[model samples]
Target: MLPINIIGYRRIQNRVKSLIKGPLIRKVLVLVSGTVLAQGIQILASPLLTRLYNPTEFGYLSVYISILGMVSVVASLRYDTAITLPKDDKLAANLLVLSLIIAAMMSFLMGAGWYAVGDKLVGYLHAEGLKGYLWLMPLSLFGLGLYQTLSFWALRRKDYKALARTRISQSVGQLAIQTGVGFLQYGQIGLLLGDVFSRMGGGGGLAVQLWKKDLQLLKTVTWKKLAQTAYEYRGFPLIASSSAFINSAGLQIVPLMMVLMYGPEVSGWLLLSQRVIGAPMDLVGQSVGQVYIGEGSPYILEKPRSLMELFYSMAKKLFAWGVIPTAVLAVSAPWLFHFVFGGDWREAGTYVQVLAVTYLLKLVIVPLANTLTMLEKLKWQWFWDIGRFILVVSGLELAYQLRFSALQAVVVYSACLSIGYVSLFVLSAAALKRHVSRSENELSKALMPDPE
Candidate 1:
């Protein structure tokens, strides 16, 4: 009986495996499994992490990370994002080089700024043990920025497997370090080190993997080419950079503000709740976005109507995945959080519930928002980013000043952000529609014979 049951189970496993053997399905499964495995590691570790590092430690770590996140998007002047756009590898190489150069410059500037104001900044964030750690942000940011530049290059290579593997490696490195450091009683420094080192593992590995294939291309990156590509993609630096920065602020500023307004304890709770929720969100949304941009960007540019179709396809899929799961989380967060992370963390569950709608909207919109870059409406992107940032900051700050509960403030911020995200989606659809219209007009003109 046991042998028969084992044989049956093996047959089912083989059948499932054989079913996903097609190219697109295999790629999606690899990336999805990698992302799921990575997030699973974190989600599984959260209970242990919560036990090992107190709320205050996480609070400090969140502040450090928020600052890094906000600044690092601009590290490459958003040129890393343009790596997939150019058909010419030489042009892409030049863009890649440009990203590294700007990343270094920005990282150095951040370090310089920190050197001058490290103490004031620590005092401002109420960071008791973060003065020395702040110095590490520049290095962390540089690694992260380099990773972004190369990851986009990898995307151009269609190295989705490598990308998926890196996600797993990063999580493993982080969890290993964090667990070990917790035992050494290093406090928040351990969490910070774990994050930085783990990120380095992923980004550094990807950079090294690409170096061999791209070594000759790297050599070909002349000053003339770099200058030419940078000038050609000037819109990225001019328009996309601010837009990306502002978009980052919409997500990251809340943690920094929480620290300022509600102290580390409340901020810690918020950060933990966000982490748990974002784990799944990122696992799905980021994986989808990566695949979408990798496969869809070129098609979208060449066929604008296809871009609109892809947008609809992604919107429908994202809607199905986003709304219902979040509603469940909102309803069950309190009991689930308390059970999983202990009693002290129940407050974060409430915060997660309040944040559910905003996060859902973000989940739906962010995956589709890359279409804006495809259409060169980064100006519209900048506009929407400003709107989101303003909404998040103003709503939260006003609620805080009015003495609303932290949860209440988050609710207000979430409502505002949800509205902003929906608005951006509408704008993105409009942009894609216009792009299709423009392409059609150009095609019609080209097809028509010249009058003699």
Candidate 2:
């Protein structure tokens, strides 16, 4: 009976090992399936959401989400990117624990702060009823931060099957919950509830898995060591993450400024265009981001030269992907918007065209941004981001004050953002090249036989 049990256990272990050792294509199949289904839900939900809620409602949600984005960026602190890249499980655990601790502190602060001062803040935004929703805001953002950070462990383990399953489940859960609530005329509560529930479930599930996998690890690990490790490793990402937060805030800032300068109608149109355009970009970009971070860091550290060329090629491929679609969107966006959404959104198509052109230039350089993180050159990325943020914010204000129309503002913003992306790409590529060349020079000398 003992021998029989041993054989069964060995068979189960071998099956698991086989799945892990499967080809990249097989792994990506699982990943893609989940992503596709999730994107499908998003696609279906968009039209329903558009029908159920007016653009004004969406605009309100957009502003609310933008604020949430900034807060989430702070909560995450780029720990997601950091944890997945390092090889040490203990270090990963430390980072995870630290992320949770910081996230808890941030969540508490944000929740408390919002509760105390939300009316003033909401009034400042010129949006009514926002104060009523303030409690929901911090809960949603904190849950999202937790979900994103916990997702890093799945990538680190190359457990794409699990990752994909959780993502799909979350997306479906969100769609189902939101749709049901919308049917019940719950207003924006539906959207907020969907997000909060999805994140809580996904993050909580991942945390459970991590704990079950290594139950004794926490008992053996010291808090001091965890703190030191997290501090040392997360420094770069912390700064880089702040830059990213600023970049996203830059996008939202334009709409707020537009509302102040123009009117809610123009702001709504612009915000609508941004939502339609940003949805697909985020879906695709985020999916690739996980894959690159999961797989690229070890390759860069071990084979810097090959990884450099590989990264260059990957950038070009991504560029091509963005270029073709952007070109089509640039030419047909206005007409497409009219046909799909009627004349109400015709102006939005123009906004789409403007963003499309900028997105092309951005696509060329953004892939390199991921590589920069993999190479642990987060500071360089931060420098470039800060420079662009300053130029963009300043330029947009000037452009608007000069009475530039929506088109002009879009073009100026795009150009500045493109410059930032290009600058970061140049910096990342140069750093990688220098490292590779120096290593080669040393290796050549070591391998050469000395003459007596």
Instruction: Find the candidate with the highest lDDT and give its number.
Output: 1
Clashing pairs in 1: none
Model 2 Cα lDDT, one tens digit per residue, 1-452: 57998999999999988876789868887887887777677766666765565555655666677678767777857776687766778777777777777777788899899888888876776755455888887778678778887788777778787788888888888878888988888777677678778888788777787788766765566789876877687665656666778767765676666555554456666766765676667667767766666766776656777778777777878887888899899899999887776566777788788778666766556655777777677677667766776888887888878999867877887787777767777887888888788878888898999988
- The model with the greatest TM-score is 1
What's model 2's overall lDDT? 0.74
Q: How far is candidate 2 from the true structure (C-alpha RMSD, Å)?
A: 7.9
| Model 1 accuracy (lDDT, Cα) | 0.84
Tell me the spans in candidate 1 whose CA falls farther than 4 Å from its real position. 1-19, 286-324, 363-379, 425-452
Segments in model 2 whose C-alpha atoms lie over 4 Å from true places:
1-25, 76-95, 156-158, 207-275, 282-322, 369-377, 424-452
